[model samples]
Target: MPQPPIVHTHRKPLVYALVWASLPAATLAQEAQPTVLDAIQVSAERGEPASESTSSYTAASSRTALKLALSHRETPQSVSVITRKQMDDFAQTDVNDVLEGTTGVTVESVETDRTYYTSRGFNIDNFQYDGVGLPAVYDNVQGDLDTAFYDRVEVLRGANGLMTGIGNPSATVNFIRKRPTVANRASVAVTGGSYDNRRIVGDVSGAVTASGKVRGRVVAGYQNRDSYLDRYNNEKQMFYGVVEADLTATTVLTLGHASQTSDTDSPLWGALPLFYSDGSPTHYQRSTSTSADWSYWDNVQHNSFAELSQQLGGGWQAKGSVLRLEKDSDSELFYQYGTPDRQTGEGLFAYPSQYELNTEQWVADAYATGPFSLVGRIHELVLGATWSRSETVDESRYGQGIGTALPPLEEWTGSYPKPTFDNGISGSDWTDKQTSTYAAVRWTLADPLTAITGVRLTWLDSEGVSYGLSKATRYNAVETPYAGLIYDLSHNHSVYASYTEIFKPQTEVDRDRNRLDPIDGVNYEVGLKSDYRAGRLKSTVAVFHTEQDNLAEAAGTFDNSVDSYYRGVDGLTSEGIELELAGEVSDRVQLFAGYTYVDIDTANGHTAKPSIPAHLAQLRATWRVPGTTGLALGSQVRWQSAIRQNQGTVSGGPNDGQPIVTRQSSYAVLDVMARYDFARNWRAQLNVNNVTDEKYIESLKKFGTSAQGFYGAPTNANVTVSWTY
Candidate 1:
């Protein structure tokens, strides 16, 4: 499939503001009280019943990413937070490992550590690091940061261009980094697993100045997995550091950096077939390889960012952030596939390829807020603007080989995935600049009602240079609007609504290089939300609809250029319901649960996007006996509906005009964990994943699939221990 264009998420929302109206006094605020939901008792005017928590726009709301992480209750939107504690418990290295049990979130692998993320049944490739916007990429990718560098991970679902710049209304992911501590602290951990896996981690933090005006922290970690997939194996190294300084009593400065590199000797795309005659889904051996398989990846990524904050006196506050990042990947992978030579029972297939990609980015933003009451009542409105730029280039080559999928054992000849390296840069040079002007106010209206209304105007200008085909070509771009509203019922509950717009530019264009109008989309949402339990529990339920216009579907499989793909006659639309919950019961017991139901169709009522699972559900829990301080147990079960892969088409394959087959069957997996706190300074833990060893498709696979093919992981596990100082 042609990759989706990179999307900017920090841009302001427009157009949508003109289509929706703000309800009277709907902003909600949490109060100083207690209830079943606890910590989040706030008031609204939208007729929502009083609850223990709230999703309000009060000046005290929407703090740092850490605040969101600390919150266990419902906000007006669908959100999830992964804490440092959770990372420590699992000794998680990759983002996929860290979020496996989180509610409202799912992570799956296409190959090795390379992965994908989805929320509310939509592909959410965009992510924010410390509130800084990052462009979304279509390729299977990995974030450079390790769990040792993050204080927490925050997930915000639905239209978010108001805070981000550009993106699908799907959802946004933000990774909050840990800061230096004024107190000294240190810890270490080691891990071992089934695939001959081994890992070690070290962390240290403390004050650098006598008066505690300056402090710093550092983290280092490494992991090595020998693997169960014949020659597939890898080793990863991570380093992270953070520093904070108080220039004065009211001013402070903070900076942080993270770097990671992974070297892989093998990555299994697929195994050899046991019996082509059987044609059953289950046909593979544990220790299978077509040839003496080998793969390599020299991956490197680094990120550095600084933030400044100063109290302006009064009830006002101000903050700003600047960040820079760089990423480079060089790799080679080969495998085998195809029918065997009848008598030899050996197939003649091979795939060999090599490529490199380099990307770097710089982004900055600033915002201010204070008191304003021009609408009706008093409100603390926030005003802000952001700018970001990223440059990426790809170089590749192809050879006759089996495929990136199957292994290349003794039976294969002819390599197909030959690297196109000699062909030069066949892609392009890209850049985008955007600015937004937005204001949000919180109206403290009648008794239990409050409202928050915000509007933003954003302008975008993008240019790209395609350097292949013997000639140099370039293209330029243009802007759009955004608005949102929330109604509070009382100190505990509320209902909210939001309308946002998204604008994206495509690299594929007409023969003349004339850039087409930016593809546009509008999203609408109305829902109920609440949270409580003094930082322990939260729940949110909502209904939403999204419509995109001027979108171009497949002009034909290979002709994905703008000139070739016509505007989709029906467009794309989606409507759905979602519920999420999380919390801790009595410190020793904790749980997270969520469910999503979605309906999507072409503007003309055809099929939905192939990647997303229509229904997703997960429940996880951890518990320990109150009196015993050493032992604990954990379990998580997840369920997802079959994936929707293809639609009727004439130019493609055998089923021309017939609905393309391959529906990933609905499947479930269960994982368990056991922990022992041998002493105050030491602990041990073990995790069992996919306990049932069920075989099912976990990805929206295509490549050479006939009908329904491909399968998820069979099963895996890891064990670890820690020591504190």
Candidate 2:
């Protein structure tokens, strides 16, 4: 692939205007007289700087998006942070749970353990661990990392070209780990919930040396639960440990390890069929099971990491990190689908299969950041480089009785005999490698005005070998650019505009056995950000447009001589607006709210993306009792518009080659929570979700067919007790 020239000429006028407008502020600041204060008195009264966990619903500052310590209003992009306090209050345990409540994000489930996240009409493919990028693969199962070891999760919307080398222009999520604390602390908790769910967690941290230069922390958790579906249960275990040492006054070294494992019995592969053979809709009970009792799925993941940080002269700082990860999964499941007869319940078939996967990944990065004087103004700059590699192997076997008709639904029970895996087949072995060099600068053109500009140069290579066939692909020296301008209108308000680009390499081939060009994406965004009550409350209103081109699509019929042919097409375009508010509204009240509206279209407009709602809204609030010091109560409500199922044809069935478009109704769910601190170091809480128990479809066609219409969870409640010392 050839590199494209950097484009900045179009944004020069806007950048100039912001710089000119800030000159007055700069002049006033220089001419104003400073008031002298009593140094001794001020020093005695000043408190510690706020940490990330200070607020229940908002963070004081973040460094995930740009590797710069900045407040929400200081960064010219859409960013949302989910704090530990918020997660604890809601009893969120995993990455999926945390993202479900975030602004402009949506989660859809394809199976019992598989989920997909999306934002701005595109799939979110970028995930970072402590600012280091991780590979996102589609064919393998994701571990759905546990949140117990993380202090917070930060989401940056739009193209993150500088940090993530190549990906979709949707968003990037960064999980910030909890560091060892200087002071000793310990805590333990136990929880019991509906459907026989039980969980226990322990956390401890302290200084390992008498001088308090070495610190260590450990966290462990276990959970066992049974689902609403019949004969389905799961067990999960997590462990994390870390050590931090101050080799010198200005240098630090850290090492950490994390492990997670999950075992599930009778895992569901897909949902019940949505329609009957006669073209009429079918409704099944939410507790209906499509899995047999003998099937199971097991997954395990392990990660080890090391980091070093040093302070150089002239206020400069340098940091480096290395991480290795290993993951494995094995599953034997049944997928029952196809339209059934309305009266006699016939024509339903079962497909049983088994799969095994193993993956290993290594990633490393190093960066240096500091401030410099440019034209008598102080500006900040960061330069970094990253390298990563991943390898995956997969194997599978299918049952011989696949496609055989099952008994009538009326006489069927949840218990069914497990099928045999006879015809075995091995999938391809794949490897992916990436290297990138990136640089960013925060230029203070004048007081109250700043410009952020960066670019990443990337090289990617991939190879696959399957069943005696081998292929290799490469994308060399591709460039992705980013630019943003932020102007402060007042002490509490700011307006900003940004532009970013995305590059994604494709593996499709043309008629002549030549690979197609990579897909290109450009994103444009403008927004207003505000802060209230001294950074305790934050809000943002943003509008964005994204365009993608050079999407590989089938162009002509398959040729026996050279396989199938494809060509680049004018790709998808999306425009949307988002609104978000989070943090303390008053002394005793905290709130979080968000809304999104998106419109998407393609060049031909022949097919629409399924299961994407046009409108979404969420709100949650908590209030402490005025007289009762330890009592608090909260509630949450979520609403979304109708979704369309875009299944094109039945493909050799009763409704063969016929269009099958089904619309799922909109829905709203409600939840409530209460907490009481009975003693100084003891507390108890309860949470009731889906209070009304409304039955609705959570997703339609999450797996590219109406046969996978997943139902939402029913009403459930949980209670927790904790002790701290």
Candidate 3:
């Protein structure tokens, strides 16, 4: 995406006055002058614009960690921002697709509808919207989440304890929504591609009142597509609308609503068998599937929010916001297990079931930030508080045949008789609540030195019943401390170091049938950051080390009730190094690239997390043809080291009690794209992914004789046509 005209974050009379002041000079000029220069100069006085239409891969500043607007050179963390333009160029319409291209992040597509993410050798459980945290009730993405309603995705790598109540030490992902604009503008896009894929999206934003005091925006889209896997398809619909009103000269009120639905057919419940009866790895075609013709999983989600902000005197501001989120899912699925014969393909079984789950959450937060002077030096301080409550309910129904043996695999199709769901039903109900207060300050210690320190106090309570077990937990006055220092090495270079603590509440119990204490850890990092090309380009080199205690590990023992238990493992450590560069290299060339290397020490000869690769690399760039007007070319390359999983023993087959293993060697994927602008307001783009058609497994952790595993997509192409006014 190319850079668009810049605009102010908050629309006010001062913006209108500045625009009018520049108009006269532009009108009197002999040659037509680009008005974007004037807009950029004026918008610079205010905060940087969101990445909505910036068309650049880098952001000028972000406040995802401590609610302070600081540039990458000033912040003491590694961050990656996926801009809207990058999404359009690569056709990354889903969150999984986007994160797969990010730096130091891994997307684990364990199942068709269930996904997991990890970073720096830890699981990611923290997610935010426009700087506000929202806990994941299920700790997994249950369905495909579209990106049509978001302007950009900000990824902060490493532990973030101040903002997110539960610090997981993995990463934090923040989604920034598209807001209403003071200028009237509209755009529509139509796309079609391989597998009979089809989609259409529309966006309209402008002033609702003649005086521009009130503004509104609307975005809607629909997509239907077939997958490379056999007997699988999905349809999606999404809508978002927001309105902003300037109630007074220095006060603003905003309201927004967003909804999305996913309807999928033949979604997989469990993956194909990865090993044969001979204890050897099994290979299948890329188009192979384990779903029945009648199996389906559907999901819907709705979100509503309201915010009010007041600009106080002397550079001080106060803001309050509330958000409500609801989600529901329904599925009827079939699971297959057992290793079959390598020659005759026999000895497999099936289990059928139905499930329904629902989740509701409410979150609200308020904060005040401004500058203060002490000892003839100026500094900044922020104070905030947050409250959140989430409830989840689920029910499961088993079919008549608990475990029915299957026919020969070679002759078997998804043509089994639908079992009668006459068995009894079981359900679970759980609720969790959290309250937190935090304070942070930035002190200008010297001419070239700066320091930031903060702390958070959190209270947690959870209660409910899971299956036939009781679930109750409580914790009070959990304190997490944060501190950082930065020293300016030069006008455009800086060196920094930071230390932070992490805490996560676990649901598993110890062998004694007692709920284990929460997991706690600490992180230390130091890095060098530099800016070039007048802040249009940025680079960072960081080294991080994390030490964790009280991590849950399987005890390999069952309690009196036959339920599995776990024990706390301490002294686990992970250390890594990261390198990144993003932004325009020159007038006609732009690039974003990164490389990450991590090493883990289990500290007790425990089986390490083999699914996380030791090395990762991502490269994306775009170049404009010098002689050809309105023509550009781009490409993306991603590579990762080998990953493997050790499945204990083949069960219930000719190779019973035999060791099995699944592995995917190191590989790289390449994608190419071309875009052409034909008319004043129209353009067309073509994107081809996996150009080499590399065949690889999407995830290895979910691999076993019966559980989960899938293949990545093959060579595919899509064409998009867009018009803007």
Order the candidates by TM-score, highest first.
Answer: 3, 2, 1
What's the lDDT for residue 473 in model 3? 68
List model 1 lDDT by residue over 54-134, tens digit each. 211111123322112112222345566655555554445667765655555556554454666665545565677877866
How high is the CA lDDT of each candidate model?
0.59, 0.77, 0.82
Residue 598 lDDT (model 2):
83
Per-candidate TM-scores read: 0.80, 0.89, 0.91
Model 2 agreement with the true structure over 150-210: per-residue lDDT tens digits: 8888898888877888746788888888878778989998999999999999999989999
Off by over 4 Å in 1: 1-75, 90-92, 104-108, 143-145, 268-282, 286-292, 335-349, 373-377, 399-427, 466-481, 508-517, 551-569, 647-660, 701-710
TM-score of 2: 0.89
For every model shown, the clashing-pair count is 67, 0, 0
Alpha carbon lDDT at 692, candidate 2: 94
Relative to the unseen true structure, what is the C-alpha lDDT of residue 1 in candidate 2, on a scale of 0 to 100?
Answer: 34
For model 1 the TM-score comes to 0.80
The reply for model 2, stretches above 4 Å from the true place, is 1-52, 139-144, 409-411, 466-471, 507-517, 550-569, 604-607, 649-658, 702-707
Model 3: residue 547 alpha-carbon error in angstroms = 1.0
The CA lDDT at 37 in model 2 is 32
Q: What is the lDDT of residue 636 in candidate 2?
A: 85
Candidate 3 residue pairs in backbone clash: none
